[model samples]
Target: MSLRYTFINVLVSIALLSSCSTPKGITYMQGMFEEMPQEIIQQSRITVQPDDKLSIVVSSKDPELAEVFNLAVARHQVGQSITNNNNMQQTALFTVSPSGFINYPVIGEIYIAGLNRQEVAQLIQKELISQNLLKDPVVTVEFMNTTVSVLGDVSHPGEYPIDRDDLNVIQAISKAGDLNITGLRENVLVVRKKDEKNIAYRLDLTNAQSLFQSPAFYLRQNDIVYVEPNNMKKRQSTVNGNTVQTPSLWISIISLLTTISVLVFK
Candidate 1:
């Protein structure tokens, strides 16, 4: 084949290969319409896990009586006045141990892992009533550490607190400062733990319709959302602080060599 034809083929190949990510890939919810029916997607429930910090509050009609079953939170000096203590009232945060149990004031150590926030509160309330400690105890439980990790190719990659229990993948991405321009919008990875093993789910944000059907649609506490970098961004990244040639670089090098040979041989 002629050198001119070879060079043309080389240039065309580079141009085609360079188009790794297109404008369509960058656009989110492509082909979506205003008349499209919305799908009902249920948010995942966050279960209490080991090392989870929980705030449990016990309340009843008789304030003095309820205080007996509650742990005294030392907000200030122990000898502080009642008014000062009231102003600084704070529930003592309970940290679930590795064994999935918390040392309660009266019930001693009780397993709480794998239980939801409401179920945990109900368990405590039942214990109080069963022990005849209180006629009817009202217990409230809230997760003090409902955070999700957003890492890789994101504007802000770190642990973000999820105030709402019904958080989803889209919300998690928004909290991470949204995916950067370099992030691979089509391939986002969600890492979750189950049965002491890690399970990863891939989500395509470019297709909003399919995203609803994704298993990672609802984000669980401590779930990790990893946005991988696209080809362009991967090429820009350095290896060990040293510049490395990506596939495009090698292709460019070959094209240059082929063109040089064509001119030298012509």
Candidate 2:
């Protein structure tokens, strides 16, 4: 074969191989058998933290008796004109103090941080019974402003509210429209704040065992999940697209090959 034809064949082969190459560690929960081990499966719960807003409601057999224990709804005029004004009522939200205490209607200050929603409800129920305020009180507690932020290499990165108590890392990612193709699944980062200190944990989505064993698997309120971009993606972000696998590099190589072909023929 001629030298020019040999060189052209090699370039075409290289381009074909590069185009066929697929990224590794993209599939999640790999190496799973028919049934997962019971020990590996863990249940996670959401715990209340400082600065969390809570909505606590107390109910009893008698509606009138329960009304006093619950926070009264705040009402405000909606329209600017007096004739067209409408009264709008909104649920009163209780912000947990930095010291983990919330001022209840009659019970005053109650420390509730680190407790789950059910535990908070039980505590309030006990308080009402102990104070002889309600004979059969049923208290319900819910997180008002708890959310987790998902950023970097996600389809739709944003802050997602934790609607349920047991929102896991997988679910949180799904909420953000899952990670993009260029996301680095091997080293997904979860940043959590506890005791005024920020702690970071890395989880490998490719390994089910490692992901399940991670403490940050169950995301907490205000947690941040960051999916770092792969090496190729990082390179593409640069002005020059500095990588042999990049499209720009491939274009330059094709241009060089075309020039060599013309010179060889001429």
Identify the leading candidate in terms of TM-score.
2
Off by over 4 Å in 2: 1-19, 34-43, 78-88, 246-266
Q: Candidate 1: lDDT of 212? A: 74
lDDT of 1 by residue, 1-266 (tens): 58667776777687667656466678776656645446646546778899899998889998888887667686565555445746687777899998899999877898999898889999999998998888878998999988999999988899999888778888888888888887898999999987679999998888877887777888888899999998767666655322333566666776787777677767
lDDT of 1: 0.82
Q: Each candidate: what lDDT?
A: 0.82, 0.86
Model 1 scores worst on lDDT over the 10 consecutive residues at 237-246
* Clash pairs for candidate 2: none
Evaluated at residue 192, the lDDT of candidate 2 is 93
- Highest lDDT, which number? 2
